[model samples]
Target: MDVFEALYTTRAMRRVKEDPIPDNIIKSMIDSAIRAPSGSNRQNWKFLVVTDKNIREKLSNIYRETWDYYINSFLNSAKDPGASSLKKQNDKDIETIRRISNSASWLAENYHKVPLLVLALSRNDPTGSSIYPAIWNLMLAARGHGIGTCLTTVMSFETEKVFEVLNIPNDKGWTLNATITAGYPLGKWGVAERKPVDDVTYLNTWGNKTNWNLEQPLWNY
Candidate 1:
């Protein structure tokens, strides 16, 4: 797929079909991932491609525990007295949040059923900027191969348990950064509406807006 096509269509796809991904495809995705640039060429990233059923179950338990808390918190906040808004708008926001939370909860409950689980790690004293770009590349690479992926971090919060389950060394300078679940998508990737470039980009100063008619053919009207 073209770079622009991948960028535009790589949504957070949580629902996937019950299908097994080929090992070669997984290897291709990871190969693309490691080619991403790292801070000072340190390449301080480690990946655990988890296919073991027992470990996936353990991770699923941790994920669901946190997902429930998150959903409940959002529901509680939406019920607060201070959350006044245009009724329709407020209702839409609440419903959207609820739907997303439901999807996350479902994924947590059935994590072990997914074709692949990837645990990404970074150095404890990371440069703080390089990891995300590399992960983004991984997501794009997966998208190109018709695989859906959800980048989640709930498992990272229970770092010690993850280390124990994965047998990661304590002195390896590693810290769990994220977990990504991948499988064949159940539906087409949807387009995410984004703010116009003019609304976000500034000319030379922070607040100065620039006007231009320049347009890219890839995103042509």
Candidate 2:
């Protein structure tokens, strides 16, 4: 797959088939991930690729619980039925969020069914600058192989439970940065919609506009 194609279409594919990803492919995903730059070149990252059904079941339960709590908290905090956040969002933004939330709900309900789960951990990187690029690289690599992936952090809410389930050393400095679900996609891949680059980008000054007027994704899959 083309690199630009991977970057453009690699949205969070939460809904995926249950077929197992090949071990070689999984290995390549990590190999590509480690090639990503790390903060201060420390390279202090570990990926725990899980394929055991029993372990996935345990992690799924924890994920479901946390996901439920997260949704409930968000809903309960909405003081007004029309407004979901402290700063009111426009209709388009709300709809986009609604779509994402629905996809997330599907993943939470079927977390155990996803073929693989990769837990990315890093030690001593407080800002997460060291690990996130590797995570993105892993996802992009999955896209290259026609595999779907969703990077989620909801499991971080139950850090100790996850560590116990995975037998991760608690005394060690390892922090659970993200949990990425991987499998063959059940849906078609397409370019993700976003605000135009011209709207977001600025020139040398903070408020000075670039006027590039890039209204669509540069690449189409």
Candidate 3:
């Protein structure tokens, strides 16, 4: 697959088939991930490719609880329903969120059924500036191989439980960055819609307009 194609179409593909991904393919994904740059070239990252049934089941329960807690927190903080323009925009967002939440719930319930669950860990990188690039590289590599992946941090809420379940050393230095679910996609691939680059990019300084009037993506799949 093309690099740009992978970048654009690799959305959070939570819904995936239960077929097992080949070991060679999983190895290749990690091999591609490590090539990504790290902070000061420390290269302090570890990936735990979890395929065991019992461990995955335990992790799934923790993930489900965290996901529910996250969604409930959002619900509790949501604004009151109203007929104003802001409320209308929020309603639209909420609708989309509900759809995504449904998919997330599905994943939580059947996480163990998916083929691969890769947990990324890092040491001393508080901002995760180094680890996330490599994690994204792993996802992009999976996309190149026609595998779907979803990078989720909800499991981090139960850090101690995860460590115990995975037999990870209870060292404060090593932190759980994210858990990525991987399998063949049950959904079709398509370009993800996002705000145009021109709207977000600045010419030289902060708040300085670029004056680029791009209303659509410059490239096509």
Candidate 4:
């Protein structure tokens, strides 16, 4: 696939068919992932691809636990009048948020049924800035292969339980950064719509907008 095509369409794909991914495709995605630059060339990251049924089942329990904790926490916080960071959500925002939440809840309930789960671990990265680029590469590579992937961090809170389940060394240095679920997509793939690049991007000065007056993407498929 063209790189730009992959970039534009590689949104978080939570819904996927329960088809098994081949080993070679998984390998290629990892290869593309490792090619991504890490902080100072110290590639202190490990990608654990979990395909075993038993392991995925155990991890799924932990994942659902953590996901429930997160959702409840968010809901509880949203109910608070003074302490919540959530703004007054419009109808559109509420719809989008609930749609995403439903899909994510579905994934948590059916995590083990999915074909592949990739756990990204990092050593000595505090800000998580060094590791996420590599994870993004894995997702983008999956997009190139016509595979769907969702990058999730809800499992990070259950890192200890995850290490116990997966037999990862429970060392002080290792931190679970993210989990990626992958399989052939059950839904159609297309370019993701988002706020225009100009809206988020700024000129040399922070408040300055580019006078480029663009509405649509310059390139057509």
Best by lDDT: 2
lDDT of 1 by residue, 74-143 (tens): 6877787675553223777887877777788779777768878888888844455667777788889899
lDDT of 3 by residue, 1-221 (tens): 77899988998999999888999999999999999999999999999999888888888889888998988666555554544553344667777778788998899888879889999999988787799999999999999999999999988888999999988998658999899999999999988887777788997799897878877666666
Q: Tell me which residue pairs clash in candidate 1.
A: none
Candidate 3 at residue 44, lDDT?
A: 92
* Candidate 4, 1-221: lDDT as tens digits: 77888887888888888889999999999999999998998999999999898898998899999998998676555555674355444567656767788989999899888889999999977777788889999999999899999999999988889999988889668999999999999888877777787788789999788766667765446
Candidate 4: 10-residue stretch with minimal lDDT: 82-91
TM-score of each: 0.83, 0.94, 0.91, 0.92
- In candidate 2, what are the lDDT values of residues 17-73, reduced to their tens digit? 999999999999999999999988999999999999999999999999999998767
Give the CA lDDT, 0 to 100, for residue 15 in model 4: 84
Runs in model 3 deviating more than 4 A are: 80-93
Decoy 4 TM-score against native: 0.92
Clashes of each: 0, 0, 0, 0
lDDT of each: 0.79, 0.91, 0.88, 0.87
lDDT of 4 at 25: 95
Error of 1 at 140 (Å): 1.3
